[model samples]
Target chain A: DVKVTQSSRYLVKRTGEKVFLECVQDMDHENMFWYRQDPGLGLRLIYFSYDVKMKEKGDIPEGYSVSREKKERFSLILESASTNQTSMYLCASTTAPTGRNTIYFGEGSWLTVV
Target chain B: AQSVTQPDIHITVSEGASLELRCNYSYGATPYLFWYVQSPGQGLQLLLKYFSGDTLVQGIKGFEAEFKRSQSSFNLRKPSVHWSDAAEYFCAVGEAGGGNKLTFGTGTQLKVEL
Candidate 1:
């Protein structure tokens, strides 16, 4: 089965602290994405990488950055975490770009900023 | 720009009852539509997608969706509901030409009463 793994399930950080969420996929997908899920607001994309070191901003990319040094790994970085950034972070990957390509997601990492 | 809208915010139905989740989208031409579900403390899972050809599409876990070009809607349906089906369902739309970016709706929270 295609597996997407998020190293952290729960994390708590103080204000202005640096936060890193790691995601890895075994399927060697070419596209990877990071999104934050909040009540009423839903899941908004932060950043996406189509290839190694190539990133693009999504709808809500402002307080976050992403890294894709390798094909299997994608990392979300918050240079200085704020309370507003506290939410469930999800990482997804798709094998290729197609009309019917299915995106697979990890278990998600829940972050709490205090 | 392509966008998706899910009218229902929350829905409650007894187990073994029928379910229908509404999803509407605004796009210039034919858009790639998808339905995803996120369980409690879990990431998103692709339930189904509709690109072209058949208007009715069958998905995993006994879920199906129908795309109506006249109404610009892709609604998900299930004949019977289970307690485990309780989750947040999101409708999304993407550009037609093999693009990786997708705009997601606010999502509908499904509650199955046992």
Candidate 2:
């Protein structure tokens, strides 16, 4: 079974503080993704990386950025955390692109900005 | 751009009752379809996916989904509902030809009554 790990399970930070959410996948998948899940809005893609050092912005990337310095790791960075940034963040990964590749997700990280 | 729609926001069913969750998609051509479930404070889990071949696909925990090209819908079904099955279900769509991005729906919250 594929496993995606998120370093932080829960965190609370003050406004204007910087936040980091780390994710790592064990299967050597080439594609990694970060998504923000809100109550009514569902899951919105934040950022994704197809290769090491290569990143692309997703639909809701306005207040977030991502780094993929290594193949098995992808990190989400919030320059300045705010109350609105308090939500659940999910990390997912999949093997090289294919018509039928299934993406696996980590347990998730709950961030609370106060 | 591909998109998904989950019409029902919340559904309640008694234990041992039949279950069906509706999902609709908008894409140019054939799109990769997937159904995912997320428990409270946890990451999303893949329930099933439809690429081609089989229109009706079986997934984990006695769940199944059927793809309909004419209606552009993939609806999830279960023969019997259990209280433990209560969770948030999401429907997602991805581009064909090995595209990496996936568009997700807002999600439906299921409540099973014992």
Candidate 3:
């Protein structure tokens, strides 16, 4: 079984504060992704990295950025947390870029900005 | 650009009743369809996926989905609903060589009545 681990399960941050959501996967998958999930809107891709040090912006990458320093680790950074940024963040990974491969997700990080 | 739409926002079903969740997608070519379930505060888990071949795909946890090319739809179904089946379900579409980028629908929240 593949394991994608999100470091923080729950967090509460004040407005204008910087926040970091960390994710680590055990399978050493080549592709990693960060997504924001909210009620009604479902899951929107924020950022994804196909290789270490390589990142691409997704549909909703406005206030977020991601870093992939190693193959097993991907991190999502919120430059300035706001009330609207309070939502659930998920990290996912998959082997290479193929339609047949399955993408595995970490539990999730619940961020609350007040 | 590929997109997905889950028409139903919320659905309620009694235990032992049949279940069906709708998912429609828009893509230029043959799309990679997937069904995912998310328990509260948890990440998304793959229920099933359709790449090619058989239109009907069986998944874990007694769930299955069928791909209808004519309708551009991939709907999930379960023979019997259980209390544990109550959760948010998301439908997603991915491009074949699009670097695993997926467009997801605004999930459908399921409520199972005992």
Candidate 4:
């Protein structure tokens, strides 16, 4: 079975602080994604990496950046954490260009900015 | 641009009762539809997906979804609800062309009563 693991299950940060959320996948999928889920807002994509060092902005990319230095790891960076930035962050991975391929996700990181 | 919509914000069902969750999409060409479930503080998991061929797709945990092209809808259903079935369900539509980006719905929260 494919498994995606996140670095932190829960985190707390003060305002203006920087935060990092990490994700790793054992399946070696080519595509990885970062998303923030909010009530009534669904899962909005923040960033995605298709290959190592290649990144693309999703619908909601403001105040967030991503790193993909290796094929198995993807990291989400919050430039400046704010109270509004508190959310449940999810990481997902899948094979490229295949519509039939299903995306697998990590357990998610719950961030609380105070 | 492709988008998805899940009409119900929350639904409650007694154990052993039938379940159905609605999803609608707006896309130009044939759309790839998917249903995902997320437990509290967890990432999304693929329940089922519809790419082509058969309209009805079966997923894990006794869940199934049917794609209706004429209505542009993909609704998820379960024969009987269980206590463990309580979770947030999301519907997504995949972009057809080059990249593998998925647009998701707001999600529906399911509450199963024992």
Candidate 5:
């Protein structure tokens, strides 16, 4: 079975602070994604990495950045955390660009900005 | 651009009752469809996916979905509902070719009553 692990399950940060969310996958998938899950908005992609150090902006990438220094790890960075950024963040990974490939998600990191 | 729509924002069902969640998609051609479930404080889990062939596809937790080309819909169904089945369900659509990005719906919140 594939396993995806998140660095933190819960986090709280003050406004204007920087935050980092880390994710690691044991499956060695080639594609990694970062998304924020919000009520009424569902899951909106923030960023995605197809390979090491290669990143692409998703639909909503305004206040977030991502890092993929290695194949098994992906990190989401918030330049300046704000109350609006408080939400559940999810990390997912997939093997490759296959039609049948399914993305497996980590447990998720809940962030609270005050 | 491809998009997905989940009509029901919230649904209430009694235990052992039938369940159905409506999902509609807007895409140019035959698109890849998927259904995911997210329990409270948990990440999204893929229930099932439909690439091609067999309109009706069985998924985990006794869930199933049907792809209708004419209606451009991929609706999820479950014969009997359980209290543990209460969660948020999301419908997503992706392009047929490789390197396709997934577009998710707003999601439907299911509430199982006693």
Candidate 6:
């Protein structure tokens, strides 16, 4: 079974504070993604990395950045945490590069930005 | 542009009752459809997926989904609902070669009554 692990399960941060949400996958999948889930809004993509050091913006990428220094790790960075940034963050990974593949998700990290 | 719509926001069913969840999508190319379930505070898990071939696909946990090209819909169904089946169900669609970028629906929160 593939496992995707997030570093933090819950967090609280003040306004304008920087925050980091780390995720790691054991499947060695080539694609990694970051998403934030809010009530009634569902899950919206924040950023995705298809390869190491390569990142792309998703539907909701404002105030968020991502890094993929290694194949197993993808980190989501909140430049300046705000109350609006409080959400349940999820990380996912897939093996397909050209064709479609099933994505596996981490447990998720809960953020509370004040 | 690819998009997914789940008409139902919340659904409640008694244990042992039948279950069905509606999902619709808009995609240009051959659509890859998927149904995912997320427990409270947890990441989403793949319930089933439909890429091609058989319209009806079986997934984990006695869940199945059928794909209808004419209607552009993929609906999930279960023979009988259980208490553990209470969770948020999301419908998603992916492009043919879009790096597995998936567009998810707002999700339907299912509540099972014992």
DockQ of each model vs. true complex: 0.68, 0.72, 0.71, 0.71, 0.67, 0.65
Docking quality level of the chain pair in candidate 1: medium
What is the number of backbone collisions in each predicted candidate, taken in the order shown? 0, 0, 0, 0, 0, 0
| Cα misplacement distance, residue B94 of candidate 4 (Å) | 0.7
Model 4 TM-score relative to the real fold? 0.97
A114 Cα displacement, candidate 2 (Å): 1.1
lDDT of 1 by residue, B1-114 (tens): 888899999999999999999999999989899999998889889999988899999999999999999999999999999999999999988778777788889999999999
- The residue pairs that clash in candidate 2, if any, are none
List model 6 lDDT by residue over A1-114, tens digit each.
999999899999999998999999998898999999988988899999998999999999999998899999999999899999988999999996623688999999989987
* Lowest lDDT block of 10, candidate 3 chain A: A94-103
Q: Estimate each model's TM-score.
A: 0.97, 0.97, 0.97, 0.97, 0.97, 0.97
**Candidate 5, residues A1-114: lDDT per residue as tens digits?**
999999899999999999999999999899999989999998999999999999999999999999999999999999999999999999999977834589899999999999
Give each model's whole-structure lDDT.
Answer: 0.92, 0.93, 0.92, 0.92, 0.93, 0.91
Interface RMSD for candidate number 5?
A: 1.5
- Model 4, A4-114: lDDT tens digits are 999899999999998999999999899999989899999999999999999999999999999999999999999899899999999999999635579999998999999
Q: 2 or 6: which has the higher lDDT?
A: 2
Worst 10 residues of 5 chain B by lDDT: B94-103
Off by over 4 Å in 4: none
C-alpha lDDT of residue A50 in model 2 = 92
Clashing pairs in model 1, backbone N/Cα/C closer than 3 A = none
lDDT of 1 by residue, A10-101 (tens): 99999999999999999989999998989998889899999999999988999898999999999999999999998999999986683458
Residue A28 deviation, candidate 6, in Å? 1.0
i-RMSD of model 2 (Å, 1 decimal): 1.4
**Clashing residue pairs, candidate 4?**
none
* Candidate 4 reference-contact recovery: 0.70
